[model samples]
Target: MANRVIIVGGGGGGAILANLLQPHGFDVTVIDKSTSHFFQPGNLWIAFKGVSPEKFLRPIPSLLKKGVNYVNDEVVSVDLNERRVTTRSGRSYEYDFVVLASGAELDYSAVPGHRELLERFGDFYSSPENSLKLWNTLRGLKEGSFVIGVADPIYKCPPGPHKGAFLASELLRSRGLAGKVKVVLAVPVPHAYPSKTVADILEPELKERGVEIHTFFTVNEVDNRENRLVSLEGEDIKFNVAVVVPPHRGPSYNISPAEVKDQSSYVKIDKYTSNVQGFDDAYAIGDCTNAPTSKSGVTAHLQAEVVAARLLGYDARYSGRTNCPIITDGKGTFVISDYDHPPIKVRLSRFKRLMEDLFVATYWSAVKYPEFWSPIFKAYFDATDEFIRRGEGW
Candidate 1:
């Protein structure tokens, strides 16, 4: 009999791992709360280009390979000692190995007045509804201070706030309101971006495009009554429209061996091995894991590949690979990095922009049919590796 593998949360990491392991004879089952799997990166397109939200959504079952079982229910808790998962529906699943890929939860209520502000101004960082609402808000705006930033430092996609600011500036420019609207990006970090190498390359580009940057502007509260964002540093930024990425926390459910998780509730995993600390049979990946890397889908995708290889009895370890695509002025570039290297300074180009746009169309296939896409992905990664090794900087 094949080893039973129970994966919690059918997000990018979970789904990819299931598809990868199922064909190799693992009895894989994926449990998720939602029936639909969202292509999260597409949220930017929906907000900036007015793309329909439906384009980025797919039935969760459809994204999983035929052999993998899909449980459309919420996972309430996992008993690590017993190797059993108990769902909200009162069903229990026993597994020889388990993986957590539940991703992070966006907590709008974590910040004072943020929930109310989100209701009024909307943001593209969270859900499909909010992205659409943000599009509507942007579409109607003729001119004013458009503030885009994060309420917390440790949100998914570290570059998300910058991406939103860039896209918003581009939108205003396209609408001929560039001169009237001020695009201000206030981040909690001390630099323009978390990666100093990427920041060095991007800061000049931001200046050329007339984007204002505010570093160390950790948000204290969204003063909806005053129409300004109050920072922990005691500085206030007024805006006609403000969209701050809300704080993020770990899984909502309980995990046995409470010490397995950190204060933030993120799974405490061995960074290179992807093993949940002190538990060899259990692993964690994606936004849910406290990996020393950016919380991006690419990180999850690579980690899924690593975990799958290890489960198949092959020696594999994650290198903390992360790729974040940055789009600005109708062009794009990627901040690619790993444990051995800092982010590579790639030049912005139309080809990179096309690649970024093309991923949306190919994302579902990449997850559902990894066997077919693996070679292509390997080649892509190889090319990126070569690019990085050459010390290509712009």
Candidate 2:
């Protein structure tokens, strides 16, 4: 009989792992709270390009392989000792191996007055409806300061706040409001980005585009009454329109032996193997794991590959690889790095921008049929490896 594998939270990592394992003699079941799989990267396009959110959504079942079981229900808890997962519907699943890919929860209420700010000004980082609302609010803006920043330092997509600022700057320029509206990007970090190499390359471009960069501006509260953002540093930034990426936490489901998770509730996993600290039969991936890497889909995808390979009895280990696309001035490049290296300098180009846009079209297929696409993806990764190692520009 095949080994029974139960995956929690059928997001990118869970779904991809299921697809990769189902055909390799594993009985894979994926449980998720939602029926729809959202292509999260498209949120920026929705906010900036006015793209419909529907274009980025697909049924979760449709994205899974036919042999994989899809359960649309909330997980209540997981008993690591029993190797059983209990759901809200009172059903229990026994698994020989389990993987957690629930991703991170967006906790807007973590910040005081933030929910009210979302209701009034809208935000792109939350949901599709909110992304659309943000675009509507932005298109109507005639002038004044347009503020974009992060409320928390550890939200998904480290470059997202900067992407918003850059995209908004371009949109305002297209709308003939560039001169009237000030694009201010405030970050909690001391640099424009966490990676000094990448930050150095991006800072000059931001200045050239006339974007105001405020460093060390960690959000303390959104003062809706005063129409200002108060920072922990005691600085207040007034804005005509604002969107702050909210705080993120791990899954709400209770995990037995609370020591499996950290103070932030993110699962404590071996960064190399993704094995939940003490349990070799269980693993965690994606934003839910306290891995030393950016919380992005690419990290999850690569980790999924490693987990699948290990489960199939092949020796595989995740090297903390991540590739995040960064856009500015309507062109794009990537921040590609691994445990052994920081991001190599890559020049922005239209081809890279096109590749970034093209991923949207292939994302579903890549998730649903990993075996078929593995060769092609291997070639891509190999090329990127050579590029990064040689310190060559693309």
- Alpha carbon lDDT of residue 114, candidate 2? 90
Whole-model lDDT, candidate 1? Answer: 0.89
lDDT of 2 by residue, 25-60 (tens): 899999998999998988888988899999989999
Q: Give the TM-score of each candidate.
A: 0.97, 0.97
Worst 10 residues of 1 by lDDT: 385-394
Q: Rate the local accuracy (lDDT) of all candidates.
A: 0.89, 0.89
